[model samples]
Target: MVTNEQRESAFLWTLDLLNEGVVALPLVSQDFSPEDWAFVFEGLPQDLRFSLWKALTEDKKSSILAAMRDDSREQLISLLSNQNLEDVALASSTEQLVEILDVLPKRVVNGLIKKLSPADTEELEDALNYSEEQLGRYVNHDVYSVNKSASVGEALAELKLEDLPVYTDSILVVDDSDHYLGQIDIKLLINSPKDTNVLQLAEFSDHVLAADMTLFDASESVKNCGRSMLPVLDKSGRLLGRFTIKDAIDVYQEYYEEQLSHMGRVSDEDLFAPVFTSARRRASWLGINLITAFAASFVIGIFEEVVVQVVALAVLMPIVASMGGITGSQTLTLTIRGLATGQLASSNLKALGNKEVRVAFLNGILWALVVSAITSVWFDNPWLSVIIAIALIVNMLIAALSGIFIPVLLDRMGIDPALAGSVILTTITDVVGFFVFLGSASLLLI
Candidate 1:
């Protein structure tokens, strides 16, 4: 068995070679796991990593890339040589190719497109024509579609001679004009008599994905269909390509990472991007937050007299705002998730809002009692306890309403809900929480 010492020694040796400008291709391919390779690549200087990456064969590079996560692959692509980039684009599936293209500059993309074969160029052009978030951008243009009149034997003969596309599970059935008719499962074709026509066994009435469908909607189609591949058709019912399960998964992962970055108020910057660049990207959101914070401070300033009169009010007011912020955040997260997954739509908004209000009402009653009891015992002031309890209930109700509406409004305004929703939600919760508590105290306690 390999000991920790042995692993460390090997890793260090690899690091030395990488630092010294040695490619170490054999050692990398034979000795290192994909994880090990990624770790080593991450440690090397950017220039040196590019040099080492250039030294590897195309197949080796593809294997390493396949092993890495999307973010890691993106970083590597950013630093790759033009020739290396061409190789990857040529070899990658349409989905992977689109991902690489998405991060590249227009000039570089145009340059790379010139290097590809006519067939690849056509496929890439089709993908490029669609919006970045559309399923058309990720469709596998290399799909095989047989005419409905073709026999199983003819289909088998075609598969034997043609270069099969990746993720091939079913042969798409099309009409004489190449319009999509249905699909024939490979297994069914293989088991059927050679003389049997494809139309006899075709699943003619099945779910077909529209090429113009958004990636989010396409993913939902993929989930509901539960098939290995779904035929993608254009507006005219022509079979353009296929959207494989693997492509659907890649779309899901890309959207997931994008949403996570949006939620964090970052633009999915490369992990090794310059410190200044990363800082600049975050500064905008931080600036917005600062303004919101000032707004909250201004509300507190309005009740300065009450705070001074009852020093305990200052100490306890933060608890009310903090609870509201946390409660609103929970609702915001759920609403954003529902929207992202296509589960929540405008039609369902009324029902969802009512459900959240009911939930908030129940939680408000229970938690208000708990806080009121604690405050009464701590300060030995029943009136102060009652005021805080009322404030808590009001804030909780407002928090729930704000959480649901903020994202919906942002989405309607064409702003990214995930990115802007939390900031607005926090502002609403803090301002309202402070206003209700301090305003109540000012009138009642004073």
Candidate 2:
């Protein structure tokens, strides 16, 4: 088997061939997987990518396209003929086909829709009816099964006539109505009495994903249930398809990518996209940050006289605000992670919030004392030292509570917590920390 590092090297080697104006297709049989080809395809500059793509056979194209990211695949997809597009759709999962169709021209979609068999059309339409996050959208239709009442020898004979499905740990056993009942392992089927019923030899399992279950839930279930794949069923328990380990892995990668994008308040865009396009996508977030910065500056302006009376306040204020910002970010990260994993439920939410506040309060008291000792020795003003200590404790308490509440409130209002939570937390901590420290000095020293 090719290791990931070797697979990565394959793309570099193939790109070397391309730069020399050499044909790239001959490299397909050189132990590099379609995934490696996908990397090479995506790595190529857009102008040169399509020329190499046209050289590949449809089978090669289909496999490589399956492994490529959506943006890169769509670039080549637009150049494919109707027959090639049809073949791609047939090879894709329900959700993938729906997304592919979304990008096609209206005329092309109409033509493509007609070419699909009635069953294929229904499945595609059915998949589209669910939310993108739901399992119904991502179901793999390439499933193999056997009737539960069939004899073991007959079932074994049927397996010999056809190829096994993807992630075929066992032959799923179903009834005449296509209601999933159990599974018979290939080992058991071969070793069982020839005349024994498949149902008698089947391993019963309730592990399944409902069509409406979110992909994240399905991923967690797949891990916890100790199964690499599970039967996907409708509300009526009729087997719709299979949710395999590959699907679970896709869900994980997608969630990680989404969170990374949301953290920067930026679109999940291609790296080699136009400079203007990437700039336009990022500029809006920068503008929002500027607005918040002005708000923070406005707070400092309110304490203009407080700072002039004691220039040390200017030097020490940042120390207070920086501490609060770091502390709040730590809490916010935890809250967002919990929400993503479905771990922050009603029963545990209040406890988590309280525990965070207690942790913050204790750390505040401990660190404030340490800062006060330093301030007393450096400035030789006990009053300034006391004021800074009080300010630290107050700001930290506020930071902790804001960290917990901000994410919960944003989620309730249908906004992504990871996207805006850090921005909002930073603004609050800066403004509040500055206000508390300077306000105490004005009241006590002025």
Candidate 3:
């Protein structure tokens, strides 16, 4: 079997027309990387750049935009005529268009903005209105919706219309008031009698999401139900638009990137932001984290006497604290993930929490035995082992409880579990774990 690399080579070979020898287009196209494209855009004659831009397919053009550097994107955008820009804009999603807009000159963005249809422009504006993390920021309003009374043939005609988005999966069916009726699978359209009404052909078994549902909520529904797309509905039951799994995937990727940056204590910054602009963005979040860490340190200060008196307490404090923190983090991570994925809900919360409690106990026992043995051997004191063992068990139990409680509480308080969760979990485990361990040693070992 050919490897992916080999398959890509063959695929490139098939696009040989896109790489003719004259003008050395083959050499230029074959070795094209995003960075290379940026360089090529910088060096090429204006006329040549326009010629190459016109020659590329929409898919290829989108790929080139995806790869192009920030500054280069503006030049490329300027090179494309209004018609070309509109095509590229429509081919891309609202998020992608916004990203390109951020880099392109305001005039170019305005020009392209004007070229998009009223509906497409509405999508861009709606997505832009919300901060990137909100539910509205990632939705695709270009979703296909049809009236229930239309025939399958009519639905196909609507789909075939150049202005409407081409979708291969399903078309949302709405009543006269645009209230969601159901969904008609495109596959059913293929096999149905052309005269069949769309309502008759539609599957009423749609899982509609609310318009204001978070990106997390949207992603969870898509993941659990395994849908290509889900219809978003208003409280009044009006059909909003289709939420594609693709959009959710894009949101997940963006969030994961943000999380990775935050893990390094950096704020989310625009890729094209100026150095000072990036620094300004980074500082605020880091400052917040610094303040939080100082608070944790202050809690540690209250027990400093305990720590100094029992040097062994200092030595072993982090062991118990780290264990609780890590275990609590594990629970917090899983619980937040479950909530995000819609696996843990009020109905099943008890069962899920109980399972986590059992898991914590089992892990606690195993680690407790290990710590007890190490303490007994190293200190040559069986009693030290007993204190450490009891501390571990107590800390682990608290870790398990805090893990579930913190996220659930934050969720109820309308706080983002992603942003505030780890902080809360760390604080709880640290303060409680240290107090439990050192207090145990003070009360029992002494």
- Top lDDT model: 2
Runs of candidate 1 with Cα error greater than 4 angstroms are 1-48, 60-78, 81-94, 161-167, 301-446
lDDT of each: 0.69, 0.71, 0.64
Best-to-worst order by lDDT is 2, 1, 3
Estimate, for each residue in 76-95, the C-alpha lDDT of model 3 and write its tens digit. Answer: 67666666666676677665
Where model 3 places Cα greater than 4 Å from the true spot, the runs are 1-95, 99-116, 128-131, 156-167, 269-446
lDDT of 1 at 266: 46
For each candidate, give its TM-score against the true structure. 0.57, 0.63, 0.45
RMSD of each: 15.1, 14.9, 16.9
Per-residue error at 112 for model 1, in Å? 3.4
Candidate 1 C-alpha error for residue 363, in Å = 39
Cα miss at 189, model 3 (Å)? Answer: 3.3
What local lDDT does model 2 show for residue 166? 64
Instruction: Give residue 405's error in model 2 in angstroms.
Output: 38
Q: Which residue pairs in model 1 clash with each other?
A: none
